[model samples]
Target: MKQLPLPMHLPARDGFDALVVGRNDHAVAHLRGLVPGAGVAAPVYLWGDAGSGKTRLLRALAEQHQAQGERIGWFDAGTALPWTLDEGWSLVVVDRCEALDAAHQQAAFALFVEAGTQGVQWAAGGRLPPVDLPVRDDLRTRLGWGHVFALQPLAEGETRAALRREADRRGILLPDEVLAHLLTHHDRDMAHLMAVLDRLDGFSLAEKRHITVPLLKKMMAENIHDLVPNPPPAP
Candidate 1:
């Protein structure tokens, strides 16, 4: 029942259905088969850079399975231990696999070995693919035993579509030019990009103006300026 650290402000639509698959449709399809009674195998691995939505996918899959009365254990690789693979765990999802230490690696290997007999399904995620993981050779090999997918980051057009969807959800009218500017200069990840909408909403309300490129520039400038330490007066 453990949970990974996710942004507290996640949109209400944080589920597999909301995932923007861009080029990862095959991987997403395999993930969908992990549900209980789906007759799927274990060690489904997904790797991608940070903010590529690996954690979100893991969380979404875990949540879906849990809702169906299945026992699910979710963990961040750094603190996750193999001992948690106790009895009655229908699904085990480990995120941040690149952070696992030697001890955890051995434990993960054991889990992989016993997955068939224990009736446990495995889904692990990391910043890199299995062969590139920092775990032991045996464990790394086991991680790739089943479906291994490299979740692709959103393309420019995909990011723009996501932004438009989020803006519509927030009941805000975002001009195409403003969207283009943010897409061009700002962080391209959907998670971070979507988060900007909340701040924009607040700024627009306080200033009594609709969202515009100039308004976003002003807000961003103030945010950056606030991070700077004020200079000391001449001593």
Candidate 2:
């Protein structure tokens, strides 16, 4: 099992359109509705395992909200800014809520309480179900108060489909052999695969070459230092 970067830059592939929903269509729908300020009062709580596209969904929605000139507050467990519900943010997205420590959990709970009163829309995700969340009990309950959808991983062929779609979007023609090599040697998850695509796109542009197996192999060799030998445990 070869390793690539733990996380590369945000993939150019995002938004509802970029997502290849299989069993997680319902989750996608609810999130898309949130982007348009659909009248669903309850906040959305999305739960899924790592590489299940939770981060992708959250970032996509945040981007949509930003595009509409809406005030959006996006927070990840690692970089949660100080937030107060009274800030008049239209949408608040909190990812990896389960990883929040005690102080951040308190801040999140405050935000949730204010969001309820202000009717601010919320889209959040965690690795664990709300009931099983390690955060404060009230916050856990609030996480599940609204629509809770468990995002499913892509089916067998969906990964390749996503790679092809992203390649098309970037106007790069990736060979089948390169795609097969990724599926066999690297992370099959869409997040990681998209990251590789992003790197490949940049590398091709910089090196003035088309995307091919040999090019990809060279890029992988050059990026071997980005690989994580022993990744941290997921929440």
Candidate 3:
């Protein structure tokens, strides 16, 4: 079997403008207000299902602050560094709160306390609401102490439209059949769909093939071991 090249990391389409609002307009608006001089000073906690743009929003806010040369403290459940509070930080962002282990939770709680004392603007995201998070009681309460927003997944039509727009933006001539196949055969989440599209586009370019159903299937077949549950028999 011919070895297929992996898709390189595509620049994420993250930012307030890139977000597909769907039913998350209010959440987006509130998040936008988190930037300095937006007149909204409360911390925010966002809860949603997978691929509901929680990470996107958090990253967007971080980017916005970073663009203005503000110091940012970003902590995620996967971070190897201790979640210590930095007094010089102008903004703080915490992601994947639900995945935090005992040590991370304790550190996060302390960071939260210090951030509160220093009036540092902060935001966090999790898969579950603060009330339902399986973390320490005090930390859970702190997660809910400010504005809480529930992000909604884009509807099917909305997702299709967004995909089409992305394709157009990328100058890829995405056919209907390819779009339908993606919707039916792959994960329906926007993030996953976008990643697949990115891979497909890269594959098409490397192979000098038109973006067709056959080409899509061929790419998937060549990359099956990387993409799906079962790998095809070795040639």
Per-prediction TM-score to the true structure, in the order listed: 0.79, 0.86, 0.89
2 against 3, candidate with superior TM-score = 3
Q: Comparing candidate 1 with candidate 3, which one achieves the higher TM-score?
A: 3
**CA lDDT of each candidate?**
0.76, 0.79, 0.84
Q: Which scores higher on lDDT, 2 or 3?
A: 3
| Residue 152 error, candidate 1, Å | 1.8
Instruction: List ranges where model 2 is wrong by over 4 Å.
Output: 1-13, 35-37, 227-235
Model 1: which ten-residue window has the lowest total lDDT? 1-10
Stretches of candidate 1 exceeding 4 Å from the true structure? 1-10, 80-83, 86-88, 110-116, 206-208, 225-235
Against the correct fold, how does model 1 do in TM-score?
Answer: 0.79
> lDDT (0-100) at residue 107 of candidate 3?
87
Stretches of candidate 3 off by over 4 Å are: 1-10, 38-40, 229-235
lDDT minimum window of 10 residues, candidate 2: 1-10
Q: What is the per-residue lDDT of model 1 for residues 78-144, given as tens digits with 9 covering 90 to 100?
A: 6645455667778887778899888877776677667657878888899999888888998888888
Q: What is the lDDT of residue 10 in candidate 1?
A: 36
